[model samples]
Target: MRLLRLPEVMYLTALSRSNLYRKIQAGTFPAAARTGSNSVAWVEEEVLAWIQARIDERGLPDTP
Candidate 1:
């Protein structure tokens, strides 16, 4: 399973770090699993699925 850092995930999803945190708090997106006290990462599949849901709902074209 692939994992992604916040910055990489943010770049991939086009969401600011704050917005990602807010979405996680709101239970709209999967939360990152803590790998260390100062490190966290998300399951790539979960993040991609969340992005896909946004695309499906907003009719946003897939990022090239």
Candidate 2:
């Protein structure tokens, strides 16, 4: 149930700040939880699962 900050998430996912926001808006990535009036973070497990999903996607056929 750990929360990962932006920088950590960025490093783990290898996504730039804008790219992460874009994926969130496009519903292709996990959403962040609001932690305060001016802060937000993602769940560590969710991010890790997302990474695992990516790995699981290896060798799968690509959509046209």
Candidate 3:
């Protein structure tokens, strides 16, 4: 139940901030949750699921 910050999301997805935002805006990525007046975070599971979806798109088998 962790909330991942931007850097962590970027690292895990191998995406730059700009591209990440673009995806978000295009409704292709999970939206961030507002954590505070000036902060936001993404649900870890959602991000992981998104990654898994990408792998699934490639018809790849699950790997450890």
Q: Which candidate is the best by lDDT?
A: 3
Q: Between candidates 1 and 3, name the one with more favorable lDDT.
A: 3
Q: Rank candidates, TM-score, best first.
A: 3, 2, 1
The Cα error of candidate 3 at residue 51, in Å, is 0.2
Kindly list the per-residue Cα lDDT of model 3 for residues 1-64, writing each as its tens digit.
Answer: 9999999999999999999999999999999999999999999999999998998899767789
Write model 2 residue lDDT over 1-64, tens digit each, in one string. 8999999999999999999999999998999999999999999999999998898779777668
Per-model C-alpha RMSD: 3.2, 5.1, 1.5
All candidates: TM-score: 0.85, 0.89, 0.92
> How does model 1 score by TM-score?
0.85
Model 1 Cα lDDT, one tens digit per residue, 1-64: 9999999999998999999999999999899999999999999999999988887998767788
How badly does each model clash, as a count of residue pairs?
0, 0, 0
| Rank ordering of all candidates by lDDT, starting from the highest | 3, 2, 1
Question: lDDT for each of the candidates?
Answer: 0.93, 0.95, 0.98
User: Residue 6's C-alpha lDDT in candidate 2?
Assistant: 100
